[model samples]
Target: MTALRIDGPWFKDERGRTLMLRGVNLGGSSKVPFSPDGATHNGDRFFNHRDVSFVGRPFPLEEADEHFTRLRAWGFNFLRLLVTWEAIEHAGPGMYDEAYLEYIRAIVEKAAEHGITLFIDPHQDVWSRFSGGDGAPGWTFEVVGFDITKFKETGAAIVHQTHGDPFPRMIWPTNSGKLAAATMFSLFFGGNDFAPETKVEGVPVQDYLQHHYIEAMVQVAKKLSGLTNVIGYDTMNEPLPGYIGIEDLNAPGGIVKLGSSPSPFQSMLLGSGIAQNVGTWKLGITGERKVDTQLVNSSGVNAWLPDRECVWRCNGVWDLDANGQPTILRPHHFTKVRGRRIDFSDDYYRPFANRYAKAIRSVSPDAIIFIENEPRHVSMKWGAQDAPNIVFAPHWYDGFVLFMKSFRSTLAVDFRTGKVIFGSKRIRRSFADQVASFKQTSKESFGGVPTLIGEFGIPFDLKGRRAYRTGDYRDQIRAMDRSMRAIEDNLLSYTLWNYTADNTNARGDQWNDEDLSIFSRDQQTDPTDIHSGGRALAAVVRPYPRAVAGEPLRMAFDIKKKTFFFEFHHDPAIEAPTEIFVPNYQYPEGYTVEVSDGSYETDLVTQTFM
Candidate 1:
């Protein structure tokens, strides 16, 4: 395998043949530690952060061969392998885990044996495990004067471990807008600007957090520097904006209003023991709607330390009146600095991304930098000079299926326009057009760089976990097929959301009840069968052009008819034969190949048709 590089909106191999990447996220459990039961539902070890190990994340080194072989056989040559900030420096600041680095190097060596190429992903959701998701360390909260144990009582965050059984489905995302996550993200990205008075160990909180994060990843890079299979690193996963540019903290009707919608001011007061009535919304067949209002965090527990005020309060954004009531001192504090409208991307995210790229390249000059925008916001103003060697890696999901957890073949919702589309023909077209928009953004905003759909997949436990008992995965198959078809329709490169080595029907992805993994041991009734452990294999395993002789014009796959079609204009300058992956799982009895005007051969062992 040759090292991949960007060449004007396409990936080119060492021999310079245009390449398209198709892969899966190595594992979902990479977000949590492998030892001490770090699963989010296990609340016993929430605060014991220093005494943990990530030795077996993604999978132990001993079990790497099995998982890597399975992924390669499924026609995945590239992988978005997950790593974490906590995994590297869980002990504390500046303490690198030498043993974990050795284990990771061994795993990368194993991946190379299967001809697998991967880029490291510093995965996170919301913030950290202690605050409803996973990514940063627990000490991050403490250093900022937060008490992790009281996050729930103060309505600062919602965690599955503390909330207990029958967890509220899809509620973890709301934490991004809450006090704990919102404040952390604001301080992490804009502390020097938004909260000038806040600091951790006498250093600005943003610099402290971002510096530690980039350095931790640099340690991994230094260990895997000479490995050709380890190509690049993602800056971060799903970066959030965290109340950076809100006009009014008391205003409602913001971008995200899933459940318990609270304004910035409301969130600040709620965390300070001021009970307030917040509006709650619910998702239904007709989209989201406000159902009722409830007074939450009624226990009046403050999330901050005793006598230590909120970061925003300490900055004089708000204050406690003489009667001990919170009052808004500076309503326009975050909205503007000196009469200029603040854009989180242009002002904050872009600078941080550039800084990360420079730091990583300083260690390994040839490493590629993968960048992503905020999940809910529009594309930022990017340019060629922003980062030298960069790949535009943004995530997209079928809003209807992802949020509703049900498949509707004839109905689809366009989240951008908020219009309900009808008919299967229109639905497929809508999906393709929506995905194509990402490529357009790359060209228009980022100088026509290579685009990869970082994360996209369906929940395996859709329709209330009906497939687990019945063993009928037709709904799951249809949902996955639709998403894959959209990707194929655009000739786009992508890495599916995940393949969890330890996923089960009971626990889902070890974090936040997400069951998106394509493989699970619980379904592996027959160990000898390579495809038995897979969920919805019919849609997941399909033919794709691994390497093209020229620019690929079109590619499509039909799941119901079991037919594959690819069309590409041959480039006369290239002599290499275009190779396509023909998985045996998709064509059990063998199949015939037809090419437009070329000689081709088939390798049965590798299941590739040239």
Candidate 2:
């Protein structure tokens, strides 16, 4: 595989052919520890974080060939490979997991052998496994005065490990506004400005955390930068702003209002052992609304360790008053830095992104930096001051389908206006328009750089696992086709959310009740066939222009019609023939091609049209 470089909105290969960086996230289960059976449902040895490992996450090296073969057969030449900060530096600060690093190198090398190109995705959610999601190491909480064991009791986080089975669907996102994750994200991104007094080993926690995280990724670069298949590195995955831009601490600031919806002040107060009746919410068809009030931390469980006080309290964001009662000191601590309000992406995320890019490129100078901010937020605009070869790699998902775990092609709700869309055509148009808005943002905000939908997909276990039970994937196929149509309409490059080799319908992606993996072990009836357990193969495995000779004008595939249409202008300068992957699955009985001009040839064995 030849190395790729960004040329305006298209990825150009070494042969000057425009390339599409399209594929799937290596796996979803890579988020948790491979050992300790750390699939969120099992709380066994939950806090024994330092001793865990993630070497076999997507799969052990022994099974790499099988999974890679499947992905290759699906026409995935590019991958957004998932790696976590906790996976690398879980032992302690400056302690790199050499074995795990070697394992990743082996995986990358193996992927290169399979002709797959990938960028390292430093994946995280909310914060870490102990904080209701996975990413940062457990010691990150310990060093900053958090007791991981008490997160659940104090209502600081909704941990699936301790919260046990029947964990509410998509409730893990609520952790972004809770005590544990919010505090960690706040300190990680804004500790220097927000918590100047709080330091780790005489250095500000923000600096310490950032330094360690970038260096941890550098360890990966040290191991795999030499591999040609390793294309670049993502700055961070779906970064959250915590309380960075909240004007009022009394109201819920997150989009997700499920479970115990605690306000910023309430979360701070709860971490300090204050009892509060937090609003519990359930998402109705219209929107998320408060349903009832639940008394949280009635037993007075402090989230901070015995030797420490709340970072917010110590920083004077809140403190005790004359009557020995806690009171808010500065209500707008996060929102207003000095006098005026601050933009999270502009102020905090950009600086961190620059720093990370510089650090990564110091080792691998040619590494392209993939930039992404918190989902839904417009990140800082790039300029002469920022790093070069940067790609705007933000994430998106069909919110309705993802959260609700149900799909109806005929019914759709507009996210911006909250208006209901009717009919299949209108619904499809709505999805395309939404994605077009995202692409237009990249053009207007990022100075016309290349863009990739770093993550987007539907949950396979929709409507109480109907497809899994009946083995009829019509809904799954339709849902997937709908998303792919939007991507194709925009001609945008993307890596679908996942391809978890060890995924099972029961455990989901093995964490947080998310069952988005295209393949699952539970559905694998035939071990001899590589594509046995694939869900919605009709839509997922489809035809596409692999390497265009020149600028691509339009691309579309009608799944129902079993037809693909692509239009592009050929660049006469490049003599290399154009390549399109017309999958055998789409036309297993054989097919014909009609070109506007020039000659063409088809290779059935390689599944290519040249």
Cα lDDT computed for each candidate against the true fold = 0.86, 0.89
Could you tell me which 10 consecutive residues in candidate 1 have the lowest summed lDDT?
A: 251-260
Per-residue alpha-carbon lDDT of candidate 1 for residues 456-555, written as tens digits (9 for 90 to 100): 9999888898998999999889889998998888888999999999898888889888889999999999998877789999999889998888899998
lDDT of 2 by residue, 1-610 (tens): 4679988888998889998667999889999989978899998998999999998977999999999988888888899999999999999999999999999999999999999999999999998998888999999999999999898889999999899889898999999999899999999999998999999999999999999999999999999967988889999998999989988899986657898999999998888889999999998667888889989999999999999989999999999899998889988899887797789988899899999999999999999999878886755767778788888887777777888888888876766566677899998899889888777777876777888999999999999998887888898888899989988998999999999988998888998889999999899999898788888999999899899899899999988888889999899999888899988877989987777898999999888998
Instruction: Per model, state how many residue pairs clash.
Output: 1, 1
Show where candidate 1 strays beyond 4 Å: 252-255
Please name the candidate that would achieve the greatest lDDT relative to the true structure: 2
lDDT of 2 at 347: 88
What TM-scores do the predictions have? 0.98, 0.99
